[model samples]
Target: MDSNWGSSSNLDSEWEEHRRQMMEEDEEDDARMRTNTQLTATAATLWTQEQIQQEGPWGGSVVGRSNKRRGRALGHQKLMMDYFVPNPIYTLENFRRRYRMRRHVFLHLVNDIPNVNPYFRQTTDATGNLGFSPHQKLTSALRMLAYASLADQINESMRMSESTSIENLGEFVVQLFTRTRMSTFDNQHMRT
Candidate 1:
């Protein structure tokens, strides 16, 4: 054996074995590093095939788009109020006919109860149109009780959700109870 490349057969064999072992370890480390990098990159999205089909829900569930949703005009067309959902109750006739309540009584509710202010107040939304008004909520509750109608009927007339009508009825009833201090009916009142 040459003195330069191979000093002795035993020493050369040991050096070659060490080199081979180091190369194997380096390959294993590289594989591990590549796997870790891939895992870290995948952690950000973590999207599965099923999740991809679900239309990318971050925190919210996939809700169906409403056909009756109000929006800005298409090609500068005027966006008018729809046939349903009354906005302002300016006249007594209009107020009474829709909500089955007199204009003065409606006004009295708005003025008397502090909580009713929040329930019936006209709010300005992003589009600057008067969003859900207090009048509408009151009307929803009244109509639901008067006709024993479902929340869907209130939803159509008020342009809100069935859940909202149910919510309004619950809140209206609670507030009415609190404001009037009325609890259980008198035994005499319900006597046959």
Candidate 2:
């Protein structure tokens, strides 16, 4: 009975030692994980800072103070060749089908919208690069309205961002509605 009692106590001590070792290992693992997480976070922050310094304020290279160039000139050239130029690639019927309006009306809107809203007018960027033409902005807006398409959908063809597309749509709708409202009000006043 004395030997049995001694063996039982030894087993209990062994079990407690094993449990203590396991707990220590678990604490070491947790500490290692915390250190790894902190290192990863530091590396990410450094990378972001380096990227910001390289990209400057415009999300582009700092040397030119220009945003990432998307070949706007090439996009404009393609647009003109496709639909606006004399003897364009697409016929008038094709233009009408795509634009849901005649070429003349589209041109009129392109010409007139800039007068009402300066946003539609093309301007030079900080880097002396000409911005998008009124036609491009109007087309982007009209395409969204006509097709119920997302703004990014036109980026490949229109060479504008999703935000730009949405802005164009809002401006176009506001200006068109304002013009129509003013015209109607003026006619009503004249009749009265």
Query: Which candidate number has the best TM-score?
Result: 2
Per-residue C-alpha lDDT of model 1 across residues 1-192, encoded as one tens digit per residue: 376655577688999999999999998997797556445334312322233335343322337854456321220121113212255424547557755777678657656653544755657666576656665666666777657677787665667666556666666655654433332234336664
Alpha-carbon lDDT of model 1: 0.55
Report the lDDT tens digits of candidate 2 across residue range 22-42: 999998997797566556445
Predicted model with the maximum lDDT: 2
Pairs with steric clashes in candidate 1: 120-134
Where model 2 places Cα greater than 4 Å from the true spot, the runs are 1-67
C-alpha displacement of 111 in model 2, angstroms? 1.7
